[model samples]
Target: MELCFGWFLLVASIPAIFAQDISHGSIVVDGTMTVAQTDDNFVCATIDWWPHDKCNYDQCPWHYTSVMNLNLSHPFLAKAIQAFNRLRIRVGGSLQDQVLYDVGNLKSPCHPFQKMKDGLFGFSKGCLHMERWDELNRFFKETGAMVTFGLNALHGRHKIKRSLWGGDWDSSNAQDFMKYTVSKGYQIDSWEFGNELSGNGIGAHVHADQYGKDLVNLRRIINELYKGSQSKPSLVAPGGFYDEEWFVKLLQTSGFGVIDVMSHHMYNLGAGVDPKLVSKILNPDHLNKAAYTFGNLTHIIRRHGPWTSAWVGESGGAYNSGGAHVSNTFVNSFWYLDQLGMASKYHTKVYCRQTLIGGNYGLLNATTFVPNPDYYSGLLWHRLMGKVVLNVESHASPFLRSYAHCSKGRTGVTLLVINLSNQTNFIMNAQNSINLKLAANEQNISRESFTHSLKKTFSWVGTKASDDALLREEYHLTPKDGYLRSRTMVLNGIPLELTSTGDIPSLNPVRVNVKSPITISPLSIAFIVFPNFEAPACG
Candidate 1:
């Protein structure tokens, strides 16, 4: 043996563990998240079809006008203006005649414009209402929200004398209205020629070829009327439902570039709205399914020829008056945020959420003008998240799915995480060291009254009686039902709770060490802000 006494050497390997800690605080960050920019990205809030008419309570009490009037001045509108620069007012419904008359002539009587009385001559009789227009303009100025007006295309109103190429157009009054809007310096960005023209129930039903022909004629009149005007509005056509075949035919026959945006409506009601079916509307997984539908439509339109953009011109969680219970719950916020996020993903520029303050699915409670969970969700997106989309990667779990965006310039990163599981808990670990702030609340804020447990109402954003003065005055209920309470956890500092007065109680932003993990409770929506982090690397 060359070496009789070979020394045995042993090496012990030590595992590398990265130590990290996170901090929490109050003062929820706003407008500090980043999102990716794509050609298809545009933000828009919806103006209900026939908003002026829909908001007139005396005319449509169930639709609620008072709240609509208030929304014109609501801080929420300003927030929306900041977030999305575009808006659409769907113009056909039971209230179509009223809007046409009101927008056409300001002094027109509120009385119903009977088709028998207001034949072709009667349509132009109403005077354009400048007062309401001023009110609308004032809000637009404050928020910088542009408008897309939807034209009423129901068959009997405006008819095409011939086929696609030449037709005696009877839309002089509508043309004048566009002229007036331009004269007033109100920029009508685009005019969608109709509501869901292919749908059978509400409006005039027409085949794809007939609708496409009518659309071409309508475009001609709009172009002829506003040819030299600064407010030349692009004409959109045949707002389709889920009829893909119809959409394909319309795109093929309709001349290219005639329509600025391809529009469609989607409401997922797998079956009827029974108790079991209502839950589907607010389900987070269900939200992703709607995005796939939107994506497919975008691809179909692209296949025809490139258009300016695509928009979910008219959409809500439910089509048949919305669901009973789930539509009003705080859980709906997840659905709303998810829809916006998904629309952004597909590069769909503008998403007009069905009705702002009517229908069971309205973002605001029609009766009180109080903001609903969806409204709060909108407010959060407007205030905190910026337009830029960032690459957010998360470990997938059925219980939790998240999207993250860095605010423009990387001031902060916002993680919008949802816990879909009814009972399972989830933990989120940061891949890098970053500062964090958290705010969370449960989906349900309603409580049974002491007098009658059977009757329940939203106790969070409305008035209620309580023995304590502080509790009685606070509008929103907290985890305690009497006081607003939320905790902020920091890495090495004491956790602080938010007070009923909406102030953070002496909490400071604590630094979180690198590679720390943050845990989330079940059925909660938590917004985490990461400050002082480097911009994520982008290709």
Candidate 2:
């Protein structure tokens, strides 16, 4: 998809405040709040299920042997996996390679195959085979998730030479494990030959040309082995840091048709960088720039061959230590939504967030699977939004940014408005009949700040000691409501009132006789779904 950004404005009004009592506006959506989906209108997260210190490489290993081995018959894990109809699992990391060498009886002395300091088991000497092929097969069968295996491609003994590229580069043990995983009906969507080949800056340095050749050889082998399959797993190469030239050359030499998708990595914040600036990197504007970069790279690839999709295979809001402040807050939701909107606008597909539940950027707290603010946002998105984008137009309003999309069945439309200005008000005018459902709160409110038990007061409503105490207490009290109110506003000679209800106490979508300008408050997000509309329905 082409990624481009442009400013737009809408100015118009109509008559009639329309309302439909039949509840004809019900709409369904998949609102997963995943950056990958935002980047590409597709949502997927990475899964690494290894135990801590179970295999030493880098970072703490995940300790979940029992969890991983749970019976597929159980509904909890199975249901969770099903919710993720389309998921991607990266099977190898530094730790994974360590496990492979120490556990698998690969005969070769590949770089990754060599035993390291404090090795758990003698690699060349052999150790217990810990390959979890059966476990993985059962999991995928139960969850319906796809796998992307990262094979060891380091130099020295592990490097798969031009002639031996098709053959397993690692010892016999590793090859057997690879073949076994594939045989168990596990579908491999993509195979990244190695991890961050360009960024690591060390190991067997394979230039773009070399990498491209190796990729071709791997693809040939995979295709030959699975000849009857209707689709071949994409051969992804250069799994590295951004190198436009290297990527372009690889595409040119390999032929565009040979590759399925181009992959790269991006971390907004790195070591020594100020954490306070983390929000800026995660900001929608910056994410737009990243999308533009993706567009530009895709354009370069298109020059050599037909179009190929792109993916930010690995990325998070932060890198080194994550954002000191903003990574875990409600403000991050803005970043998450903006990223998804921009990515969808550009048509990029398949965004894979770096970590699902670890590190600072994780959706859940590293130790507790309890969701962070970002996770809640993700859950909402996955549960509420649809896959397709809709066309929307907004008038000039510095405080509010809006997006519109029709539901999958074209029965309803969802309009999303985000108010970024801290103190400004936004007035919105609808040119047609529509229904709105809004979710809003003060810009600074924390997830834990409000609970279901607390009663909320609106800025516009007045309170009385009792229903009949208006004259009894002689007290004039401010309204407990927090939303703006309008009465009989005229637009093109039609009347409308900005009203509120119990469901959305902070905001209201009033029926309008004419599409007149409606105001929005600072730092709020609103959604209006139009089930059916006709001109001048209210009048």
Candidate 3:
């Protein structure tokens, strides 16, 4: 009677155990449903348009004077650059418009200008020397970064007598700058005309039609200057916040094939010092707010500029510089990784993070020059994610945001799962009779011993796998300890740090047996790679 009662209890508890309010989701990897083919140069960073003196890493024992002169040759920065294969560098920001190119040999290297009230905007009306430009080019050449130089277009704008109306701007100074660029034998991949001059604008405003006309003039000059060259660089424009009507007008006026990449800036968080910055990052809704802009831009591009690719030219999340501790810590990865996944899903070709070496949000610390938590997140994405994006659906909880893509060169798919809930864990499984049964049993049994064993399940419906082809790899990104808001990040329980010799440590992922459901802890992000599932669609 005792044995029979025990057996009966187990059988009756099956449904109750699995039915507990644990969120259940599924990832549908239908080959027919395809997202955009992500660009090989998808992960990009930036060097602000501001001068070196305005933003400098602390002079510690390392004795780094200026970021402009920071040894790109250093093993640390060099290796980080090389890891991405081809990381594009957007060398411009709010200050690009106020900067002047000094082609003449001037004895005074620094041409001082008034500091703007916003401290970070405009290069202080200073003259950037030819020597500095050359050094910058060398750094680019050495780092294998595709350079996009934002030219000073606002300097040429005139004060027309029309109220609430602006005239087409001139590009004579830009023309001179390009001519000098070609003469110096510096290969600029693209020339961006302006910065933050969109919609109502930031520091300065320009009418959309006027900006379009300026782009046409710049395009003509680029064509003429690089006539004999094998290939001319593209003309990128209006790097600023997305204003739908203004952007569409810019596209319509510029016409087809003029603007190569339709780019915009994103600083969703109102300010860097907002008291609720941490809560904002932790909130899934706040982080996913960018979807509106990404979706809107994609639609506009497809409607008017079908050939032009969409890109987030500069995104630091919080404007007026980023939050000191919040922007650079492990918690930011929740937003950073989610942004990458969301942007890619919405067909954003390139997502350039703001201030690669300056500000609090930089991947590398401004003072220590050390790689922050976001740096590893970027490196892992580059190494694990591929150009072909696959459809992923997580119906479990709003907190569990999922993205999938065919492994870069590997056979199966790589799934990026982000759990936004700080109090809930998640489980990811392949949706199949065999796997589902196994997952149910594992969850029911594991819960008996482990208090936090009830994980939100993500079941995927795709290609069938052989018993032998069930091997998977998982890279879990979380805080060094259990704390969600922290400065350090650990992958599979190991913190990624620079060696004593300033070298990148090996980022090893935890191997998993795919037959068993994978678990993702709370407030964490995981990259699940299925290498052995040879899906025909992925191929």
Candidate 4:
């Protein structure tokens, strides 16, 4: 149990005693068209710069997980990353703005982060040594990961007030770092500028107009540094909370064709220490609230930065280092997976999780290098779902969150169904949305508003016009021991754990016949792959 705090210990106290009804839901998968598309590398995670002393709620969770000190040689570390053929690893965090790159720099002494009274976020400026950077690049290459480095946007700025940072951004250090990266042939996928310094800012603030102008300079530097290279890393910026007015201004100021990725962050569950963390994670209303941000970002990007796309540069359900027992537990996948589905629906190219290994929000245990429940969730999405997102219409309770995509490198579609209710089980059926019909008791209807009001349990049929019985692959995930805060995850009755040699276990799914409904147990998630689905869009 990593970061074993009491945040969700009482989640089961005063639990429901009465048994609930089993709901019959029909999930209509649109096969003819796609509503949105994501990047091939949609599953992304982050590594932060927090030191051992970066404690929250009197607990020091960030241990040896900073970009500078992570155990790159650890067997599990490499294997976990390698599991995703090419996991998108975003190397950045709050302290990235206070960081100084130690490459071709002779002005100041490069040192590690030190806790200081007057420093930003109470942490003094940290330094990233060139040698360490080289080592990181080597590890990334060995693990076959795509890297997105966050540059220090406050390099030349000074604190003008309590929260305001002023003056022009100094691109010299970042430019030197990029030049060194290019010289060494290090392959970086993207370079993100700044952290949570948008809106009113988190710990520090900056004007959007100035940030935009500095981004122009950054793009120029990227062009100069990688001039002859056939491909250059993309520019992602303003990795912070979504501020409509500020976002509009930044894009207008930067003009078109400047930003490649419009990245933002979120912590919809509020603070990590809140008592109702588990409740918020399970509540459908709370989960759907993030749709506003994602939807608005889609609109804003379309209007102002049409050249760019959206990326959730950083998002941990709870903000301050995340919740100890809540964020690192199996139940957190409800929030994580739902957000992943929602983001893809809004055309988000990449959703960078807050920490791959740091704090309570890490996918891997900060010190043990073991995968958490959300890690399995991410790996499943990367392996099963493809870039083309199809339309899935379900009129079941909001408790059932469903998303469909063309199966990755396979025919048919993959349906992700999450049952958030702790008392009700969802008997889900996947029918083609082409011309879906109701059960025996209901009248025939079109597929536009395809919802099934159950006359008992609705039957599941093949998406194609065939009498052949097909089997779907299902991966059901539930918390170990019915504990929502349990760190261990049980996948299809088998616990997901590394081998004695520290390798990821095989995630094999159970096959069920097409006539059988996809059974989603209470508080469980299922990634059902219909191998024989007649999806014309995927074809």
Candidate 5:
């Protein structure tokens, strides 16, 4: 009888046990002021040139996925790129400096990368044949992918010391490659010089002044190569870690208008082999650490190189090929999405992920060519997030992250809210800029009081014109399973997966009453679009 009574008690407590706690909060989206703006093709991914033998932490994750070996005929590959409309694809990596193009000039026979005892990253110089280059351009054309090819910045420069490289960059080979590209009628959006040749580069380092001089020469070559062309490519350089002194000199020496985009690489979460990788991704404090770099870069661009903007040329939360299990899983989306929103807020023009495919961090699976959770996140971001960033504040909790932007090609605002907490489902009320102005004029009411209200209505939109006007679209994203490490993503209540024919699944949202507070589930992200909401700035 005692056991029976215990069973009855357990059954009674199931609802409360499974339910999450509700925390009330306020989110004031000041749509009147635009905080920042990102590029139209803000969503970007990279296709690295790592060979199949590139191993890390006792694991070989990269397979036949370099520029020379990636299967261009793969249907998933083309569909994925086309999904972004015009996804900016950067082709470069650590080995980019050692790469030599086989386009023009009479030199030694071109060869593939071979294992070398003391070679940069343990591999000899790699070559890109003209045929392969033409194939890549044709693939880009078919997929409508914007290309930003990285030139061999270390070509013709002799190694001075351990990792220090000195001497002028030989532009002959690069010019020949550019001339061929122009002759083929390929459309390249930008030409990036070097990989990580700035501030004690990854495998090789170059002095700032020398790099600057070489950049000026590269600019001259570009002008000559594409003279009178309607669409002249922009120049981007110094794709490396952020070094205040090194970056300042590169800009000062190269001077303004020479470099169009100052690119940098970021691996804020440390190495991929760390055991504490997932824990760090969930920590708000750890994520906020990247703000210093982004904020500082914004200042540097506005002050030093006003002509050129900043781009997170390459960022994979945990570098060194990314965590084998963690990076490609759903948990990585927390870090990836947060960084994208944070970068956009800081006026970062473009943020290219470490890879489109190949590494463990690739948006698509290396073996199956399947879209991972982060892939869906990127697609939604591309389909939803507009260029204009809006000011959004959440006094709810430190764990809750909120970012608002004018809706992409729409008449309202889209609020991206990420709940890092595992137990608290936040209920927040969103107000437009009208509240800010109203509260500013009425001295009796405090700003805090202005944000907290039920059935908050905007004065401009006198009343609901139709039944749909009272609703907002909500896209709740969570792991397929309750586990944070799940590879699949669940949107609302349905699982996100590709069709049998390899087409990307359409992202659909459910409409919820706008008068009621938005209930964001714990450990989930909500992209709520207020289509009919009166956002004067958006208008």
Candidate 6:
């Protein structure tokens, strides 16, 4: 019903078959696809523990105290965790480098968050109580999240000369923290050193040799402490903006195998609050610029470590906090989903979204911790996409950006086609429509039907189309009010909202027959699932 235009009513009153002759142009697509040789972990999100006081701002909804102690009892979080079974969570941010573990609860007293000119401050000098650390570990275990803890790399180096190589750098505090973690039997998947201290630093800078030395020391400590275990947690370094020469030097000096995951931070879209944020996301050229960085990182990593994987340590689109309304709304998904598609193609093993619950760009709403539009996009991605990345080429207009991957545990491929055009419609050829059965487990609602029916069922079976045609399941993401600029998001015409009890609403997609070629409207995104391709490698 949401797809019907008012003008189409009079036209629909006529014979259903004639309606097909009265519409927009069609763009034929060639579905022949190829799978990449390598496939890495697809999605990784972050839970920022720094600036724990971000909640003090009126625009920020996350309270450091509550987020640090979040438990599985929160249904919203529970559902998200359940969806991404192997979710990777990075647990630190800017303040991490300045923070110290108060083993005895005797560091500086905790202070209220202060609003700095750049962003929120005050996470720099507080002590992380052993109790809070334990609680966070408990929550991680319950959620089955693979944890990557960021350690303080700038601790003793502050107040020292910036050019000095190693005198002020100390690992005693880190050693103590590792010992405590081992004693507590908490398993960390990776331990990252420092926070935004790379290119010219974010208030602090450490030379490549110095940082490499620190990473080597961390590796030694991990080997010594976890020697008896089967596998030790990985050592991640820099955790800052990517500087071509700086990163290459760090990897070379640190030597092969020193860092398991080469991580970097990105805020290429500028500020989330920018008035032209939506325009920027829709621009394919603007979105494609980041590909250079992605390619560069992958090239350097392969050249140096050869074994190390590349990751986007933190990315929230805009910096100095995100855009007020733009980053949090349905419009943001244009950038978010495009990033997901782009990053995976460039061989980024793990892409961590900045702040799981803070600022304006968080996947969950700050106050209620409800699932945002991006959350559902990520959920659908987790459920439908497999590890194998596929190569797909579209002959349609540049506005239609399409990506394909093998369907998760299914025989066919899943295509994610996004329409950036605000006014044009693109159509693809189809043989016969397959009626989708509304299984309770399928997560789609069958009650909401479209007012106008597309029943022409034009058949054009190409050489690519097998005698045994495949069935498709479509999950479309559009604005709640059908406006490209609107913030609210709906899936298959169903608006996603939090229930009265603060629970996650049923994210049921509307099912339809794909008997004929389907039309993709402007400024919308769809995940079309084609089952039974049975690609040899995906299985």
lDDT by residue (tens digit), candidate 4, 1-539: 21131123224322532355678878888778989999999999999999989988999999888897988999999999999999999999999998998888647678999999988888999999989999999999999999999999999898898899999998888888888999899999899999999989999999999999999999999888878889988999989999999999999999888899999998999999999999999999998899999999999888888899999999999998999988999989999999999999999999999889999999999989999999999999999999999999999988899999999998878999999987887777777755443343355666532343331123233323444655678898988987888999998778999999999999998776665667677899999988877777887
Looking at model 5, residue 63 earns an lDDT score of 91
TM per model?
0.65, 0.62, 0.84, 0.92, 0.93, 0.82
Give the per-residue lDDT of model 5 (tens digit) for 30-144. Answer: 7777899999889899999899999999988889889989999999999999999999999999898888889789385679998898999999999999999999999999999
Model 1 scores what on Cα lDDT? Answer: 0.49
Every model: Cα RMSD to truth: 17.1, 15.9, 8.1, 6.2, 5.4, 8.3
Tell me model 4's lDDT, rounded to 2 decimals.
0.87
lDDT of 6 by residue, 386-406 (tens): 777776655567778877777
Q: How well is each residue in 211-285 modelled by candidate 3, as lDDT tens digits?
A: 898888888898999998997898887898899999999999988888998889998876877889888887878
Which candidate should be chosen as best, given lDDT against the real structure? 4
Report lDDT (Cα) of residue 157, candidate 3. 57
For candidate 1, give the lDDT of residue 465. Answer: 17
Candidate 2 local lDDT, 1-539, one digit each (tens): 00110011112211111221111111222122212223213565555433333332244323332223323454434444455454555554333333343234455443323344543233322222334455656677667777676665542233354322232233344345556556766677777666665532223335666667666766666776567887677766555666777777778777746677677666644431454554464344554566656777667756764556666676665654245345554455555556555555544565566555544555544553444555434443443345556444554543345554443333444555555554454554443212221113334555653331111121000111112211100001010131111111121122222123211011123332222233333444444544432112111
Ranking by TM-score: 5, 4, 3, 6, 1, 2
CA deviation > 4 Å runs, candidate 3 = 1-25, 51-75, 104-123, 159-168, 432-464
Off by over 4 Å in 6: 1-41, 52-73, 104-123, 160-168, 430-470, 485-487, 499-515
Which candidate model has the greater lDDT, 3 or 6?
3
Best by TM-score: 5
Task: In model 5, state the lDDT of residue 451.
Answer: 49
Clashing pairs in 5: none
Better of 2 and 6 by lDDT: 6
Query: Residue 205 in candidate 6 has what lDDT?
Result: 75
Error of 1 at 334 (Å): 2.0
| Backbone clash pairs in model 5 (N, Cα, C under 3 Å; residues 3+ apart or in different chains), count | 0
Candidate 4: misplaced stretches above 4 Å? 1-18, 437-463
